[model samples]
Target: MKIINYREVPILRQSESPAAGKIWSAEGSISQRRHRQTRNGDIDMAVGDSLSMDEYKLTLASPAKVVPLDPNLVLPKPTPDIETAKADLKRAGYAILTDVFPEELVRTARQVLADEIKREEAIDESRVAKFFVDPDAKNRRLNRLPDRHEVFRQVLEHPVVLELTKHILGPTVLDESYLVHSVDANVTRPGSGAQFIHLDASNGVGHATPNQSRFIWCLDEFAEENGATRVVPGSHLWNPEIDPTGATTYESVPAEAPAGSLIIYTDMLLHGTGANISENRERASINFGITTPWCRPSINFPLVLDPEVMKNTSQTLRQLLGYSSVMNGGDYPWESAPESIRSLCVPAKMAY
Candidate 1:
């Protein structure tokens, strides 16, 4: 595993480290991260901010051992292959699919997102479409990504991602009704502190498995310094109500990988983004979820993607984007109505 600083470990002796009785509470806001309240009461801090040797001196005092990553952070499992990837994902609640897309394609994908962000930001200075840039100016999640570029449409159905979705969710559960829950971008700007260490969903995880999973294609090389994703390995096995804060170390190992690699993880896994200490680097990634049909997706696909844009996209892309919800028994107004009747309704403001 590529660690940001092994040197922070040696700053304090085993006893001097403030490992015990340190309190962690979620205060201020969600993005600010839950701060670790040192026992002295004079000091308190959050994770995303660059840790000081003083904080390390205190944090290391906890029983959370600062050990080198074991079994590695990014799975070495070869992929575009199913069985190996499946095995790793099942075991760890996550897996890495290496070299699934070429480096150039991934580079262009990042560029496409960058352009979209710029264009969207210009339209509404306060709010950029679906993205709500955090107050810290560090992390921005670009929602409704499929609507932004045709290239993203290709990314949504990448072969390995599809296969894994099928394998994890299974044919019985899927029943040909799998849907794209959300297609978005996770851009960690320089100095963007680490994100809240939490699961995507708390239900059906740990005690039970979930139907939703994501394949986050790395659009930039993920390194410890540039805010690579952090994972607590197998925290998916904990009970549903188990608190992650004091129960486990938020001191996570960075799942460092190449730009074209995909980090596949279930919503259940305990994970968060590392702090980007770099002054001039951003960790770019595409969060594409292939999920079961039951839940209302993270974004209402049809509402966000206008018909004009859908016309130019491929049929597969169109379906994934919920254009074919009509085909999947989602037809409420009229089952077999003409296109006009299907999309339109009698005027609500009609006069006699």
Candidate 2:
């Protein structure tokens, strides 16, 4: 019930931050330290402590609202040919492209982020909206900007990522990309990381049809100790509910990789972020998704992007974004429905 900025949530203390060279346990909830009010009304609490504006509710003071970074400003290097990208994606839930973006672009973006941290101007304190926020604070959403920032857009439409999407989804794939979420180094703390053992679909069941896929981009290196994402291989093939006794049978493995790596997996895959035990650094990433035309998106991408942005995007990108329709039964070039019926119902286009 507390309201606060998203960036200033105080999850890790300056001294307790994780170091650069090791793995550590970030599981379990850390207790919230009490806040002391100064005469001028300023509140003081160490880092990694919860900032509750009120009891029973914690607030996250993020710097800016989440939005997509622009794709045109900084493009990733040409990905491996489609076939190679496909093979890597299939074997592992994700793929890594070292030195993907122009080294300068990556350096600049990181510099901007670092400067923001120093200025303390990037902290967003807004309460998470209902649609995106999880009922359990354990899985709360973080703020990320999606406006036409070049880096955000480039990553969203990265060729390697799209090529692989096409391999799994088909040649006619569209760009169903958007800013799924972003984490600030200062705000994310140990245990506050997403550690739930669940699929993205469990939040709300889709049409009982299978057509969605997710792509995760690591803007920074993700290691096992710094809350790198973890996935259970092949769990996407399991039934929706895996009994607790069998839960342990489904081994949880970390999706560790360097910056510029992309992890693509089906909606059925079981995954979550490992705990952030490191007291020194933050883990940041961008998550995008694409589904068949018949299925709905986990995030509303169309609503976020304008027509110009959509129009400028590649055809493959648009298809993955869910802009096109789906056609079934090999019906091509013509429709045989009666005039009256055809007028009442629009045809569905398939994403091959």
Candidate 3:
């Protein structure tokens, strides 16, 4: 095992001077036995050893085909109560909670998304493009939602959603194990094609459980005619060996719900976007993902987030963004931390 010196972390260093944060790198491995372990019973520790990366390959699933849905399939329906929604999540691997957000809030979020998309288009038209599954170029994806606008950040902090996140991910010895994985928006325009069915959890190789969950905030009413999300109910509990490829045909039901509804699902669940067949109606949803703290988030919020937004955000939001997260037995510095945010520095006592 490789041992890292916590003091070597630049952000935790006492001095602000450039030299004080100097990083040490060596080509050869260093062992503590060379210096202090001339005496017996001293632990032989590898300090500067290079770690090797292991490759675990998978049998690639074949390309999926846009197939017709089985209308006879019965699945969980949307509910207004939290208990029922939670029950549905347990039973079907997904749940839809209606009226979770006020209609006005949904409207504001839609407007904000539109404005942000426009701004992004102006900056780089390539930023907005059709989903890979949408060959006709009807569907569009907007990435990094929280970094785009305050409305997205506000919606991402919904208490109910956070509660569900905690429920799904559970807690570690330190604190809540989950952190913000990513936030994005998916817009399915008319004639948009169906997406390939897949699992959100990349680690679902064999018996491994899901380490991630998602919150899909509806910006527009989802209907069968429009592009509602389609899911294979109870698929999360299915044996991992039963891999469904693009060529495979599986029964799926639309997770239809009204605007302002929230859809919760685990990464192990097999799901995809339904094709939009409506002439005028469009389907839009803001997708937020939360995963265990050990997982690398899609977006590096700490490195890329606007400083102004970071300065004014709430403690929960900061924690969710991984600001307070402990890595390799070290966390953010306490002494240099502002009084307003110091509570986040150490939620769990470090054993060392």
lDDT on C-alpha atoms for all candidate structures? 0.59, 0.43, 0.64
**Each prediction's number of clashing residue pairs:** 6, 63, 2
lDDT value, residue 210 of candidate 2: 31
Residue-wise lDDT of candidate 1 within 231-338, one digit each (tens)? 766655554643533223334467777778888887777666677789999899987776665555677676666556666555455445554443344434545755
Q: How far is 25's C-alpha from truth in model 3 (Å)?
A: 45
Which portions of model 2 miss their true places by more than 4 Å? 1-85, 91-99, 108-124, 127-145, 171-191, 202-210, 240-249, 306-352
Expressed as tens digits, the lDDT of each residue in 1-352 for candidate 2 is 1111111122222223456544222222323222222344322221111222232122222112221222232211224345554554454444444545676665555555445434433353233212122222322233333343446656656666555545655533232232222212222334444333445552333324234457666656777666676665544445434332111223355667676565566556656665565767666666656555445554554445555544555544444443434443222322564443222222233222
Compared with the true structure, model 3 gives a TM-score of 0.72
Question: Per-residue lDDT of 1-352 in model 3, one digit per residue for the tens?
Answer: 1111111001111224476675422222232212122133121111010121100011112223333333453467778988988888887889999877888889998998888777877897667775443433667789867667778888767788778877887765565435788888988889775654556664643645778878899999988778788777777777464343223335566788888999999887777777677999989999889887777877767666655556777767776776665554356465764565454343322211
TM-score ranking from best candidate downward = 3, 1, 2
Q: lDDT score of model 3?
A: 0.64
TM-score of each: 0.71, 0.54, 0.72
Candidate with best lDDT: 3
TM-score of 1: 0.71
> After superposing candidate 3, which stretches have Cα over 4 Å from the reference?
1-74, 244-247, 332-352
* Index of the highest-TM-score prediction: 3
